[model samples]
Target: MHVPDGFINAPVSVAAGVVAAGAVAVSLRGARKELDERAAPLAGLVAAFIFAVQMLNFPVAAGTSGHLLGGALAAILVGPYTGVLVIAVVLLMQGILFADGGLTALGVNITVMGVVTVVVAYALFRGLVLILPRTRRSVTVASFVAALVSVPASAAAFTLVYAIGGTTQVPLGKVLTAMVGVHTLIGIGEAAITMLTVGAVIAVRPDLVYGARGLTAPLKLRVNGELVDAAPARDFTPVAARSPKKVWIGGLVAALVLAGFVSFYASASPDGLEKVAADKGFDKNVEEHAAAGSPLADYGVEGIEAARLSGGLAGVIGVGATLAVGTGAFWLVRRRRTESAGAQV
Candidate 1:
């Protein structure tokens, strides 16, 4: 949920702002270890894809809808550290470009949606991977569970933040109950999306998925009535650089369809967050977005005759901006990794 400026007191928001800044700083350093040549570019595409998927809000309840949060999906496709950075970039783009999330609430969103979801989901995913059978299917199963749990975990985090700095006098218990209850259903959708996407990528290029790395189980061979370790499969070298042409082009095309064409039929009702805020009276304090006057403020270009063209152009611009920013950040992380590797060599 994108908390607007007046939802939280200024002092608490400022404190969260500091924590968010420090988290990004630490994540930048950690990403150096996780990102490489193949992953760096994919990371950018992940951000753009997430930006796109979030626009397709699915119906969750009678009048409220929800969308994929993408933290678990990103972490499973890439790595946890880089996953955090990727979602952060997407959120940043949505905030500044589309006036979707509040600028002041950036820290809160990152803390709840980025750090909390990635940490919790990845920990659960790794734990499951270690205990389950060593197979690509296991990775897919773990991804499903990870995505299922991450959404409610994020809701709990937001509850905690509200407890700390909530400006409204709403009952905490009701808020928590509603938030978790609605988000659990949303989590199922998140799981399905993550599993399908991760499964597809792994099927095509398992080498690219960090969670699926080292998928081979230890080989058992009998030597003279004694079990002995069998020779391993050929060591997998990082695949040669090829254009991300297929996946990137497909993703861009899907994004265009969702935001450009399908969005016209998306429910006219407010999403879960807006519905909750209205029911709870927390929305009364939301100030107008600073970019409310921007041509793309409402996800449509001004003076455009056709809704399709206006929304399509805005989506294209969003995709371009998100990819540029995400790729630049990941490239920096990959460069750092290269430098560190050289120094050690």
Candidate 2:
């Protein structure tokens, strides 16, 4: 959930800001190992795709809706460190440009939605993949389960944070139950999206999926009635070299279609966090967004001829900006990695 300004007390938000800053710093170093020429561009596309999909909030309960958190999806598709950076980029763009998330709360959102989710999901994904049959199906299944669990884990993290620095007097018990219960439902949607996307990428370019690496297990060969493991597959190239150009093009087209054409049919209901906050009284502390007067405020272009067109244009702009910012950050990370390797040499 995109926590706007004032929901969390100023001190708590600042603390989260510090934590978020540290996370970014560490992620920059970690991502050097994860990103290369190939993953650099795909990382940008992943951020844009997350931005686009997040625009389509699906109904979870009668009054509340949930959208893709994208950390698990990004981490599984790319790498965990790069996934954190990608999501951070998307959050940065949404805060500064679309005013979706608050500027002050950027760190909170990134920490909860970006860092925590990636860590939890990636750990679970790796654990499951290690135990399960090393097949594409297993990878997809693990992705689904990892994504499903990560949402509730994030909810628990928020509750812990709120217990420490909640702005309101809401009971911790109520907050935990509501947050976990609603987010569990949201987790199912997250699982489906993560699984489907992972499956699609694995089907087309298994080489590019970070989680799918080394999945081409050596085939068993029967030689003179004795079965033996065949030679292991060669490590032709790292993940970044695998061109995701086709997947990227297809994703861009889908993003445009969803935000441009399909978004017209999306429900007008407030999302999960908004609904929960309103019903539970936590929304009272929400201050107005800084970009309240922006032309694309509220995801609608001011004075546009049609609501659909206005929203669509805003979505497109958001996607493009997110991609650019994400790509720039990732490219720099790659450059730093290259330079560091050279220095070591």
Among the numbered candidates, top TM-score falls to 2
TM per model? 0.90, 0.92
Alpha carbon lDDT of each predicted model: 0.83, 0.86
**What's model 2's lDDT at 86?**
85
Writing each residue's lDDT as its tens digit, candidate 2 over 1-345 gives 888887888889899999989988888888898886657768888999998888888888878889889999999988998888888988888887777988888888999999999999999999999999989999999999999999988888888887877788887798888888999999999999999999998887887788998896457899999999998778786655666778889988887777777776776778767877787888777888897787877788889978878999988888887878888888888899899999999
Clashing pairs in 1: none
Candidate 2 accuracy as TM-score: 0.92
* Model 1: per-residue Cα lDDT at residue 238: 37
